[model samples]
Target: MTAYAVGQLRNVQMNDGIVDYLHGIDATLAPFGGRFIIHGGTRETLEGSPADDLIVIAFPSKAAARAWYVSPAYQVLVPLRLQGAEGDIYLMEGVGSEHRATDILDVG
Candidate 1:
């Protein structure tokens, strides 16, 4: 199944560290079949608090996503991302085509 690395960012600090992180991220992603689906584009919040930015990257599978996140090349960039932004990052498993919301919910 496809998996995603989603980040909700705030308090972004644009600096040399972030520039280095941006420059090196693509190379790290290529080896794991990861691609950016969303990278801080425009957003509209329907409710609740809003984030400064949102990022989502898709990987072939959860394992691939995990591999990319922990790889040495990526690990080196981790501190830069943390220093540049305050946010939450999550690894989410995508649902298969056969999935149905009703199947997991009590419709009663």
Candidate 2:
């Protein structure tokens, strides 16, 4: 199944390290067939408190997504991100076309 890396980054420093990290991210993703689906632009808060930047990257599979995140190429850029922003990032499998809201009831 296709997987996604979803991140909600906040308190971004917007410094030179961040600039380099942004410029270098695509190259790190290329090896794992990962591509950005959302890169943060503008949004509306329907409820709850205001949100941070939303970033979603699609990968062929969970393993691919995990590999991409921990790969040496990406790891090299980690410090820059740590210096630039603080947030949560995670990977999740995508549902199939026939997936239904009640599917969760079937999970073990």
Candidate 3:
């Protein structure tokens, strides 16, 4: 089954080096089968607090997600993301077509 990794980043203070970091990071993700499903979009907080940015990326699989997270190439960008923002990142197993009905049934 495919999986999707969602990142919720809150940038307290953005510096000028972010562009360079993103350029390199984007290329690095391709090795591990990563795709940018959502980069930055308009968001509204329906409930709790609000965040600065909402980043959502999708991976080919859970293993791909894990590999991309810990890969040395991507690891170098960690400091950039940390210094640029503070947020939570999560990975969730994607529901395939087979499970679509189950998801609806469960919701019902």
lDDT of each: 0.91, 0.93, 0.78
Question: Residue 51 CA error for candidate 1 (Å)?
Answer: 2.4
Instruction: Give lDDT tens digits, candidate 2, residues 1-108.
Output: 999999889998899889999999999999999999999767878888865888999999999999999999999998999888999999999999999999999967
The number of the candidate with the highest TM-score is 2
- What lDDT does model 1 reach? 0.91
lDDT value for model 2: 0.93
Candidate 1 global TM-score: 0.88
Q: Write the per-residue lDDT of candidate 1 for residues 59-106, one digit (tens) a residue.
A: 999999999999999999999888788888999999989898886796
> Backbone clashes per model, in order?
0, 0, 0
* Worst lDDT 10-window in candidate 2: 42-51
- For every model shown, what is its TM-score relative to the native structure? 0.88, 0.94, 0.79
lDDT of 3: 0.78
For candidate 2, the TM-score is 0.94
lDDT of 3 by residue, 20-99 (tens): 56777888789988888888766667998875576777888999998898899988888877766788888888877666
Lowest-sum lDDT 10-residue window in model 1: 43-52
